[model samples]
Target: MASLTCRADCTHPANHRHLRFVWLYFTTVNLSALDLNLLLVFHTVLEEKTVAKAAAKLHVTPPAISNSLSRLRAVIGDPLLVRRGRGLVPTPRAQELAPRVATALRELERAVGDDRTFDPATTRRRFVLACSDNDQIASVPHLAATLASEMPLAQLHIVSIDQLKASDGLAAGIVDAAVVPTAASHADVHAEPLYVDHGVLVLRKGHPIRAPRLSRAQFNSLRYVDTWIVLGRAGVGTKMMDAFLHRHGLVRNVAVIVPGFAAAAMIVATTDLAVGMPMRVAVQLAKHLPLRVAKIPAPAMPIEMQLVWHARTHEDPGAKLFRALVADAFRDKPRR
Candidate 1:
C-alpha cells in the first residue's frame, strides 16, 4: 500500500510532455498504477480552476497543485485541464466527470464531519432501520409519508425486531438507525428524543367508554387486551399496567396479552376488550381503522421514543435529514 500520494512542482514544457507520456502509459498499459490521491487533487483543481487557489485551499504550494494536475492528467489519460488566459478550463472528459467528482468529495466531507453525517435532499441514499412491528404501525409510517414528499430519493428499509436487540444492528452497520422505545445506555451510540407518546384507550366509535362519564372502575372491570411490550419499560407492560391498576385500587382481568399494538388493536376493535396503546398512533390510524381513542382519567403514562445511531453515521447527510424529518413530524406541532 505504498502510495505516490502527491507531488509539488512542474514548470518546463518538457515536463508537460513527460506527464503526457505518463498518461499514455496508464491508458495503453496498466490502470492499477494510477494514483488515487491525484483524484483528490483533480477535484480540488476542478473546483478552484486556478492552481494557486486550489493549492491555498489544500494547504499546499502552487507547484504542488500543478504537479498533482500533471499526475491527474497522466492517470486519467486526458488533458483534463488546459490553460486558457489566466485560468484553467476543463476539457470534455473533465466536464463529464465534474458531477461525479463533486459527489465523491461531498461523501468524504460527510465522512469526516461526523463518522460521516448525511444530508437528505441531494443525497440518493438508502438507510436500513430496525424497529418493532409497532413502529411500522405507528412511528415509521408517518415519517415515511413525509419523506416521500420532501425527499423522494431517500429510501428507508424497515426491519422488525421483537426481542429488543438494538445494539447488534447498529454495531454491524446493518441498520443505520433504530427507533427504540427505551433509551440507549451504550457509550458508543448516540440517542436523542424523537417524541413522547402517552398511552390511550381505544374503543369502537359507539363503545360504552365513549359515554360522557368514563370511570376507572368500569375500565378495570372490562376485559382488557394488552401488549407485552410497553415502549419504554422493561418486564413489558405488566409492571406499568400494574402501577396503573394500583392507582385505581382495581386490577384489569387480562383477556389477552399480544406481542404488538396492531394485534391488540385488531382484537379489541372486533371484541369487547379495551386496548391501551400510544395516543398518537391510535389517533392517526383511527380514521382508517374502526377505532376511537378516549383519554384515561388516571395518571398519564407517556412512552418516550428515541432515535439511535452509531457514532459513525450521526453526521451523514441522509441520516441527519431523515432524523430531522422524523423529529419534525412527531414534534408537538408540525412546522409546515
Candidate 2:
C-alpha cells in the first residue's frame, strides 16, 4: 500500500483544508480490515505526542504502543505521526482523522453501554475531579475514606477548580467532573445541585468586639480578613457581602487579603480581624483554633454548590458511581 505524503504542520489552516479534502477521498477505503483497538492507540499517541507518555496513559508498555502504531500506520496507509525534534507530531492525515475517530469511538462506546458493567473494586480507572481548596478540605477526607472502602483499585485525581476550564475540560476529557458554584452553560454540560451552604463570621475568642449578637453597625465597623479562593468565575462571597452592605449604605474594611481560607482562619484566630466563611467550614476550623462563629447580622448569604459533568459520560457506570459518591460526601453535615 502506498503511504500518504503530507506536511508535518498538520494544524496549519491551509493544511487543515487540504486534509478535509483528503478525508473525502479516504472515506471509501475499507476500514473493516483495520483493528479498532489500533485506532484507539493511534488516537492516544497523537494526543499525548509521545509513545512513552501515550503508553503510560494507556497503562501499557512503550513497546506495545510502538507495535500498535506500526499496525495503525500499515492500516491507514500513512506514517500518521513523525518525529520532529525531540517529540512526535501527527501527520496531516492523523490530525484530520483524530476528531472523527474520537467521535466515532465515543458513539460506539455509548452504543455498547459505555462500560456499564464496570466494577469499582476490580477496575483501576482514574477519575479527575476539579474543586476549590475549601471543598477539598471539607469533603476530600470523607471521599477518600469512601473510595478506600468501596473502590480500592480506583484512583482520584483532584485538580484545583480555579485552574480548571470546567465545561471545556469535560468536553476535552481532561476532567471527569467538577464541584463548582455556578454550573457551566455549555449544552453538553450537565449540573446537579449538590448542597446549599451559608456564611458566618469568624473571630478570635474574647476579641474586643465579642458580643452575643452582632448588630449591623458593629458588623460594618469591624476590620475583615478576606480570602480570595474562588470555586467559580466570581469572587468568593465578597460580592454578596458587598452587595448586602451596599443595600444598608455600609461597607466593611478589608484589612487584608489572603490566598486561601485556611490562612484567613489562622489570621482571624490570632488577630482582631474577622473572616466570613461557610458555616460548616467555619465551625470545623473553630475546634482547633481560639475562634468563635457569629451570625452575619443579616440573612445568610446562601452559596449553592453544584456537581457538573459532560452529558457524554452521564450513562457511563464509573462516572455514575463517582457522581453518587460525590453527592454523598458533600451532603450537608450538621453544623457543630
Candidate 3:
C-alpha cells in the first residue's frame, strides 16, 4: 500500500489531530489484516494498565483479553505490554501509540456510528456511579429504582471519588457518570443541572443553639465538625462560608474534620459540633438520625447539583439513558 498522508485540507484547525491519528496506521499497517477490535483491546489495556481491569471494562473474560493481547503483540511485532509487579506497563512503543490509538479509535467510532448498537434491554452490563456519601444515602435508591425499570439485568456499582478528579474517572471509564455539585465548565466533560437548594446547619435536635436562625454571636460560639461536602464551593470547607464570616469578623472553631457528610452528620448529632450541608440532604438525614436543620445564617451556602459525564461516552445510547434516569431521579426541587 502506498503511504498515506494526514489531513491536508481539514477546515477546522483543531481537528487536524483526528486525521493525524490515522497516519500511524497507514504508515505501518496492512488494511486487510488489521483487526480494529484488537486495537480496541490494545487501547483499553493501556488505559487500564491491567488485563483484568481491561477485561472488566470491555465486558469480556480475562483470558479472552489475554489471548487478544497475545494476538495484538504478534500483529504489532512488539511487546506492547509487559508485566511489572502486579500491573502491566506499556512499552515505549505503546506509550508513543497510546494517545494516537485513543484518538484514532474515537474518530473511527464516530465515522462508524458505533453507539447505536447499545441495547439496554438485552445487554447485561455493570455501570459505575461516582457520588458522595450523602448521595449514596439520599439519591442512589431512586437512581437504582430507575435503572432497574429501564435495564433490569444491569448492575449498578456505586463508588466514592474525590470531587476534583471525578471527570478524570469518567474519562478513564472508571465511572460511567457522577452526581456532584455544579462545577465549572470543562471542554471534555458535560454537566447538566440536577437540582438546586441552599445549605442548612445540621445539629442534634436538642442542641443549645435553638433558634431557626443564628445570630453572628451564636454562630461564632458554636464549634464545628468540618467535612468536605464533596466538591462544591458552596460553604464551610470552601471560601463561600469563610469569606462570609470574614466580612463580619466571625470565626468558627473546628472540633473535628471528618471525610464525608454522613460522618459529619453523625458527629454533629451526638456532639455539639455543627456541620453545613445541602438542605435536602440535611432534612433526609434528620428523619433517621437525631438531626435538626437550621439555615446557615445569612447567605446560605448555595447548593447546585449536576450530573456529569465525559465526552467519550457522550454519544453512547446506554449512557444517554443512564444520564436521563439520574436526572429524573434527582431533579426534583428541594422541598424545604
lDDT tens digits by residue: candidate 3, 1-336: 001123333334555575575665645766555666677888888778888887667655576678777867776778989999999998998887876666666655555653468778887888888877777777788788878888999999888756435334664456888987686887567889887877678889899889998888888889998775445333434566667667766677888877778888888889888987777678788888999888655675566778998776788788888888877877774321
Of 1 and 3, the candidate ranking higher by TM-score: 3
Clashing pairs in 2: none
Residue range 225-270, candidate 1, lDDT tens digits:
8678744345565787778768767567888988777778777778
- TM-scores for the candidates: 0.59, 0.65, 0.64
Q: lDDT per model, in order? A: 0.67, 0.74, 0.73
Candidate ranking under lDDT, highest first, comes to 2, 3, 1
Q: Point out the higher-scoring one by lDDT: 1 or 3.
A: 3
The reply for model 2, stretches above 4 Å from the true place, is 1-115, 182-185, 231-237, 333-336
lDDT of 2 by residue, 1-336 (tens): 001122244444554554454345445564564656676777777767898887666654576678778867876689989999877998898887876665554444444642449888897989889887788878877888887777998999998876675334564456788888864475567898888888788999989987856888888889999887655555745776678767866577999998778899899988899988888688778888899998867777678898998776788888898888887887785221
Model 3 weakest 10-residue run by lDDT: 1-10
